[model samples]
Target: MQNQKTIITVTGYKGGVGKSTTAVHLGTFFGSRFRTLLVDADPNRTAVSWSKRGSLPFQVADERQAFKLINEAELVIIDTPARPDSDDLKELAKGCDLLILPTKPDIVSLEPMLEMVKDLGDANYRTLLTVVPPYPSKEGETLQKELSEGGIPVFKTMVRRTVGFERAAMAGVSVRDVDNRFKSAWDDYVSLGNEILELLNK
Candidate 1:
């Protein structure tokens, strides 16, 4: 059965593709507009750690704590363990309102996401290209075009590589709360959050 609450699951075949970061930012985005809850299911407990460091507008809990907190939440974002096998991938796809696959702009990151989509069946999902190299290099856009031409559903927003995210994490806040140099980085996610809202509404 589909979940009544709007749920998004972040996962990928490769690790360190910013899965937890995506989950955290997405949570903060929706949290301001709704009662959001971020569930940390990853073994690393990255999201859990982030919550402890700073003050977030929304509440965060581990997988176990999520059960009690979920019903009260209007939006729920799950940060799953990375490198899920095919079976787990299918299950994760089936369980959410949307499945987000975060990957860097490269063959290695792209390949796993491509493989996962092959098995999505009818799942509502989108690929987010992140940590894209900044200007003077169109690598991010180039990769996005190639993926779209190849028929993958990709978000228009590409998160540029920046250290602002790290500082925000250390301070337990969203990218917007960080340094001015990271403005573009935070804007990337703001654009991403808008795209997501549009997709779900449609």
Candidate 2:
């Protein structure tokens, strides 16, 4: 089979929605099957720092020279900053296979995320719910229902609110890299990786 380059940008209009976590783990998971590169496009450089801390297997680089570096890997996952400008957003979205938008299942996060979808105009994108309560939350259920009813594509696998995610981040490792204490959260990310791959294969 011929080598194919796949670019996935993980972004959201608002901050604190688990964009970095998703990018880090997704890149790591993709690395298991393909040569993968994780780009820290956020001015914060969170992904670069996390890789340094976790000693991730995949290569992590600053957003500079993205196209040149993309030639080095089959999959490229970008961790973007919050509230990027229109021109920058368009440039980032250009030619990307998937624009993965992470959002919390609440009005506070949902409103801005929806606004971002509008701002980005038409593009290949999917909304992944993050920081969801483990218990049945009316807001979460309602938001999922609303998005589905509106014909918006949402991930069937949601990332739950877990202290393990924070702990794993502090240790500079993906949830799966952490000990069994973080197994549940790690499992969720693995499931997410499978779902994303399935979607991309379609």
Candidate 3:
């Protein structure tokens, strides 16, 4: 393994915003090219359960095993729990190379994400819009504008809402493992993954 390890933390202020989903797929993306590990840092152990149930291509471990694996893999993606306290945020920010805040377009997710960043202070982080409408909608565009105007760093690619994710979850597989019916959804994550890789290279 290389001495340079990249720690990517996928976290959010609220739950069900696709944090685990992002962590899983992003780990898959990186695992394709580099040695990658996904850590179930969330007490819910969603990633660990998903990996056990699904045919994930990468390694998944509980939070307890994260430290040892981080040193071994080229990239480590962490699926964090919702609404971590200030101290936890500080700790995460201190340790991670990149912080990914996955959120939906609605206010239920938006408002808390804004507040959550305040706790992070100056973390190297960016917001990823998830569960967006597939078709063009004013809400998604407006939310992007608002986040931009508020000086929030956001990803250009948005993960649209699709039943494919639900199907993949039920089958214990990733969107990539699902059939062609979920191509669009899978492509969305691919685009997002590419964008993240670009950022990492920079």
Candidate 4:
């Protein structure tokens, strides 16, 4: 099969929505299968830091050099900065094969995500509900319904809130390394990865 380059951008309009986490894990997952390049566009450089500490097998570049990195790899994953309303985001989105908006299952997180979706201007994107509580409360269901009604594609699989995630973050490891208590979260990430690949194929 001919190698087709796929560029996936993870963005959020708010901070602490797990944008870097998703970018890193997805890059690692896809890298296991393909030649992947991860671009850390956030000024914070959280993804680059984590990759360095974790010794992840991926290339990292600043926002200015990310486009060149994207051109050189078969798969490019861009991790945008939190609350970014800049022209750089627009330029990155323009080249994306899929745009993933990772949001926590709460109003504070959902609101800005909606705004970012609006700013995206009808691009093909999906909402990934992260940091979801184990047994979703009524509010969680309500938020999910609202997003669906707003014409956003929300994934059925959710990433549950867990200390393991934090631990993995501190250790610069993916949730795949988390213990049995977070098996579901790991599976959800795997499912998300599959969904992403399917979307790219389409």
Candidate 5:
């Protein structure tokens, strides 16, 4: 496809922050418009397992295949191992067009993400808030404001926690493609995908 090549690396200090899931859905978003590859660089192989369960719209490759497949796709999303050391994060920041650090709103996720941000040191990155509890709770907004005020780059879109993601995972499909009940969850990612595109264009 004519889509500009963009390598996006998704990583965080903790698992279960939806890092792989974000990579998968972003792959889906870009793949639908341009050729895309999702690389399972995580030892847990969450993306591999998820793709194996059912057909994903895009290609899923183990880290070993990344070098070969990366050139063949217009968009590449790498799901990295959790807790990459400062050196690795620095190198990773220099390599990818965008380094996405997914963080949940809870303290458990917040602390490590904060530490990871500190280690990044001027990396071309943005913090993506994930697994946000549904309304009536302002945790996501609160944290986003805090981080932004602190001069950290944070995405405007937040991925809300939903069982639809679990359902989509079981079926190995993009959240929006899986069911209508989880439209909001999918919408969140759609917004994120758009924001990413806009950011890249800038």
Candidate 6:
């Protein structure tokens, strides 16, 4: 690992937004290329359980052990719980190279995400639109426009809502091991990882 370690925190105010899934898959993807550590900061321990059940090669750290892993790993991905406030977000935002907020296209999910963006108060962090439908829908387009006008940086590639993701999760496998239908999802995640790398390089 020649590059300096980069920290990425995945947060959202609402549950079922695919935060843990993103953390697991992204960690596995990057771990293949870099010495990555996945930190399960959420009290729920969903990521920790998933990794144990999936039997992944990556390591998981609790709050107490996270700093040590952060100091040692080439990359750290922190998976946070839902509904974290400004102060909480700030604490996690410190030393982070990138902050990824995953949200669905519906209004219920978008409102809190907007509040999170305001809380972050930094323009460099990236917002990822997750659980999007396969085809372009009216709601997805509208939400995309709202985010863009608000000056939030959102990735053009989106993760579609599919059973493949759920199935992979249950089996403790990543999208990388899933079928071809999810190839685009894997690519989108890789692209986001690449974007984070680019930002860190800058």
> Which numbered prediction scores highest in lDDT against the true structure?
5
Model 6 lowest lDDT segment of ten: 193-202
How many clashes (backbone N, Cα, C below 3 Å) per candidate? Answer: 0, 1, 1, 0, 0, 0
Instruction: Give the candidate order by descending TM-score.
Output: 5, 1, 3, 2, 6, 4
TM-score of every model versus the real structure: 0.95, 0.92, 0.94, 0.87, 0.96, 0.89
Task: Name the lDDT of candidate 5.
Answer: 0.90
Looking at model 3, residue 164 earns an lDDT score of 87
Give the clashing pairs for model 3: 54-172
Q: How much lDDT does each candidate structure score?
A: 0.88, 0.83, 0.85, 0.77, 0.90, 0.79
Q: Which number leads on TM-score?
A: 5
* Stretches > 4 Å off in candidate 2: 65-68
Residues 1-202 of candidate 2: C-alpha lDDT, one tens digit per residue: 0268888899888899999989988877877888899989899988888877767878889978566777878888888888877677777778588889999998899988887776567778889999998876666667788998987878888888888878777888888887887788878888988887888882
lDDT value, candidate 4, whole model: 0.77
What shift in Å separates residue 66 of candidate 6 from its native position after superposition? 3.3
lDDT of 1 by residue, 77-165 (tens): 99999989889998998889899999999888888888888998778988999888899899999999988998888899988998888
Summing lDDT over every window of 10 consecutive residues in candidate 5, give the lowest-scoring window.
1-10
Worst 10 residues of 1 by lDDT: 1-10
Indicate the TM-score of model 3: 0.94
The alpha-carbon deviation from the true structure for residue 123 of candidate 6, after best TM-score superposition, in angstroms, is 5.4
Global local distance difference test of model 2: 0.83
Off by over 4 Å in 3: 1-3
Listed per candidate, the RMSD to the true structure in angstroms reads: 2.1, 1.9, 1.6, 2.4, 1.3, 2.1
Candidate 4 error regions (>4 Å): 64-71, 86-89, 136-139
Across residues 31-141, which tens digit of lDDT does each residue of candidate 4 receive?
778778888878899887776666675677777777676666888888877776746556657888888889998778877877777677767778888877767365556
Model 6, 1-202: lDDT tens per residue?
4567777889888999999988987887788777889999889998877776666657777777787767778878889888898898877777587788899988788888888888777635777888887675666666777788878887665667777778777777787777897787777778777776666673
lDDT of 5 by residue, 1-202 (tens): 3656788999999889999899999988887887889999999999999999998889999989778887888888889999999899998899899999999999999998898888888778999999999999999999999999999999999999999888888998888888888889989988999999899883
Off by over 4 Å in 6: 1-3, 136-138
Ten consecutive residues with minimal summed lDDT in candidate 4?
134-143
